[model samples]
Target: MTNSLPTESELQEAWIELQEIHETYLLPYEVKIPHVDQYYETARSIWLAVLFYYKEEQVHKDVISDVCQRDKPGLARDQQVRHLKREGWHLSGKGGYHSLDPFQPSPEWVTERNRRSGRLGAADFTQLKKFYGNACATCGAKEGRPDPRYGQDIVALQHGHMDPAKPANDKDNIIPQCQFCNRAYRSDYVFDDKGRVYAVADVGPVRRASRQVQKKIYEWLMSVFG
Candidate 1:
């Protein structure tokens, strides 16, 4: 027996087969495998069981038992468990497990996942700008002009969630924020009654152009003191 895990295509086929099995025998009835002490109802649990069974043929009984018993057993088992849990399985009873609910990502998770995948493309940015009208929600700065002090784009809008904890890609949840305001808000800055944003703590002197300024200073010193 080989220790190799199934390919993605094989895993997908196995998942489909597991789904079919779940629908046919598990969904309408409470089915339990004899000597296994675990229910195989949901597609996720069924898939895990199948994956574990496949590995059982390749590995020692002690290894399988350890994997089934411990939470963080080893790399292979841990990976399988994580995959199953992500697909909505949960450990249950004294031994083995069950998938209680289907996988449903929170809005925040979806938004983060989309961000990671670069799914918020040009069209999405356009829509965001159109919705918010190219101004920072906090400071009301218009888009495209450079910051006077930083020399960075002041109004270059950034996507930010109204509620960072429950972030969503929806127009209502997202807003166009200026780079300064975005940074300020992220650093726990709060607006005063006069609408002036203040940082929670002193951030020390603002950073300046280092190498360019140094070169310019050197040139000025050479021209003056030469």
Candidate 2:
């Protein structure tokens, strides 16, 4: 009987076909196919090989041999590595490989870190929600309402950091915001002479309101009092 072992090209073709099938049928129907985990593992191995080649700066044959345990022909391996590099796999730094799968701290560690740093806790979240009247500070969208545009439930009020990159997690740096406004604001802000903070228009996602909601509220007050 002739040998039935699959060739490298055959394996690659099969992977492509499986991906197409997943995209066209499985994803749309939300159905899981048999041996799907195997398919995922195979795809991950392919990506890991590419990442290792870039991070290690070794020959494709050496990388693939290490990853796949089989000796691949030189030309095929070279072409594969070249394709990965072209698809944006260039090394950024000595430790750039860590960017592929950054380490995530466990939930317990996160809670302990937050506690040590005085980050908002469950009680603080409840108090903040009450202080904001359970509505978005910018949009006045109430909690539990369905967002008109997306049909998703309005995002629970989030505590936005005045400086997201180096958040202080203090009352002075935190404000209640809707999901839309929080995402749009993203880390861009400016402080006025009086120490009031405002979102920076040029650097952040485009302003969500046509006019300042806070300004409109003040204008209404001035009109009523006068």
Candidate 3:
């Protein structure tokens, strides 16, 4: 519900500790942090961005690029960010670049401790479904109708986050999605209310394509659908 940013004091402490780790080159949980440069570069900037913007906002991809992009030229900024989760950075996508601050208790943790404590109520969920015509907002799979992709007799819909990365459990941030969508698609790409793939963080999901070809595809999409 609330966004958190690292304070100046926290950043200062992190910087001091960063130097210590760099000198010692110790790994936490047997995970290597790569080579740390006193002057922050691509990897360092990414870690810093995720930490600073944790728990609410997405890490700014453009700012990360501006700071340092010494990695692959073909890699998109969001793509660079997605890999952090593998490195034990708690991040989420399929909406935008979102992160969970390790220091903070996430909505998941809270809900585990107390069910529906900060989630949408049944009344709000019903209203949301009605607004979207009791159908999957992304695929138009009407509730009780046969599944579109699969041959199920009934397509049950559930409360799905508009941006799964953020903790907006309100109706505004929710939509109806079938179980197939909620789990299968997950948050690989951010979808519009209409269920269109509006934003993609990584090209891997789209498969490997040259940068030039990808640009053309983007232009074509914007021209035709933007």
Candidate 4:
């Protein structure tokens, strides 16, 4: 039999279930992300668990480990971050600070047309850039300001709509963004040139303690296990 990919509905259902499980069981601790026990294992298992959770399929740890090894090799801690950045995986920080960038998987920056496609004109985008000072809201590095070697690559961030476009912008709808976030996720009308769309409420970061590196680890862990 040929293997079949999951339908979008299946994926959404799985993601919802994963969040439900996390909320009911693990959200209380406010310490560690549930399901991950050891540091190395935690680092390794997080991504596969999220893949399975999002794909709504049973997953094997060996396969997960193999993928991590294949993609990241000896560098274990950052594999999940790379995965999210490359694949637009739907995930979140299990603890504080997702990464030094605070925006992982980068695709989360694209805002979906949700019913508000009516309001997402060039003006909205311009206002957004102005509000964030034309720099990455998460990183604060403006265009032309990133390392010279990185050039545009350094400041090529995008805009993330605070609320899904369906509800439309009501003043609190704008936010600065970067390439490290997931784009409009699971939403129709997300254009190829525009980038993928993600839910703003689901991905936004708040004030917290952990330093940059520690937060990066925690954020990478969320990309994996969540």
Candidate 5:
């Protein structure tokens, strides 16, 4: 059977309802995707689910599921949603994303999912800052100029743990810099304290350059010049 797509008006109205729910709820929710593309797709699906569910109240749940099942991933990847009797993201029998417990905090749901994925805990900021130094590792911006609005540096520095949940707190693992730089640059491969490597985000320069190569080059240069 052919799948049905929502009309423009329906999509817009549903999105508005979803927006209201998001504003009211905004609590952290952890998402899981073992692969890179799957992760992005999951995020998109969540967004679309929110946009449509608010308007039709999930009347189109069957159609949506059918289309997804017929597509590349088929029914296997699709999650079997259940009404969140105790938390948010409850799937009513109607079968669509619904925000029943909008105000209820889903800390248990978030923590449990992240723990399963091995992505728990925030970065150890104190230790992380020492290794990378208090400057934008990329742009080398230090002591940024004051901002008129916040009465602080326009570039407020933060300890950017390469991985937010799985922080290394290592000199190489953490970078001290403003939010802009951290968001832009820190979303790449970085070395943890144990010399292990990890990818932060979906940015270019996927892998980090070898420290061994750098050390050898520096040592050779020192021997030649000094």
Candidate 6:
């Protein structure tokens, strides 16, 4: 089978920020490569799965299983994935779906999928800014306001995709987002016109689940991350 995941070289190229993540956030090695040689392949496979989904939330065990055939296919997917998370990948996984942090720089395919440029024209972006009153559509922060987190820096409105799986340059599916919120949600959620979180990309495992089960999952995540 032709592997669908991006090549390791491509991942390394797109995620240059990963070098910093390794030294600061990740565990054990203070380096990307785990010291234990056997677990290394499993770790590598999980990353490929993450990059495959890119910004899209996914039910990824199957993908992981496929890619890790050469790594550690027999190992439980969650354990391997959690190892990376605990070891320092800023990932979110629960309710059987996983999503990568949106703050990471993404591959070109996001804005230019299927050879269709989603948001190329500066005129379109200019119009979007005007429509949203020159403010971040998601956070309502006016462009050039001082960023609360970045001292002496101003907030800049960016083109954030509503559905990352689709071509992002399309005016219809795009929203004006502050750099903060754009990376905060990624494509993990869907929002409404009022810029409230509307729904998650929970189409798979969450389907047919009881309301109690859903609520428990929600509460569990809150407690874990809280």
Off by over 4 Å in 6: 1-123, 202-226
Tell me the lDDT of candidate 4. Answer: 0.42
Alpha carbon lDDT at 150, candidate 3: 90
| Candidate 1 TM-score, true structure as reference | 0.27
- Candidate 3, residue 151: the lDDT equals 79
Pitting candidate 4 against candidate 5, the one with the higher lDDT is 5
lDDT of each: 0.46, 0.47, 0.56, 0.42, 0.46, 0.57
Candidate 4, residues 49-129: lDDT per residue as tens digits? 436443543343344444445434675433444344333333444332132121222333233221234233346676556
Could you tell me how far off, in angstroms, the CA of residue 206 lies in candidate 6 after the best superposition? 8.6
Query: What TM-score would candidate 2 get against the native?
Result: 0.31
lDDT of 3 at 219: 96
- Using lDDT as the measure, which candidate wins? 6
- Score residue 73 of candidate 1 by CA lDDT: 29
- lDDT, candidate 2, 1-226, per-residue tens: 1133334455555455544544564344232223443322443435433343243343333344344434232323322323332222332323222212111222343445445443234357666666566777666678778778658765677876655545557665665777877776556664321223554534333345445765775588699997
lDDT value for model 5: 0.46
Per-residue lDDT of candidate 5, residues 31-55 (tens digit): 2211222211443343344324453
Counted clashes in each candidate structure: 0, 0, 2, 24, 4, 3
What residue runs in model 2 are displaced by over 4 Å at the alpha carbon? 1-123, 163-166, 190-226
Which is superior by lDDT, 1 or 6? 6
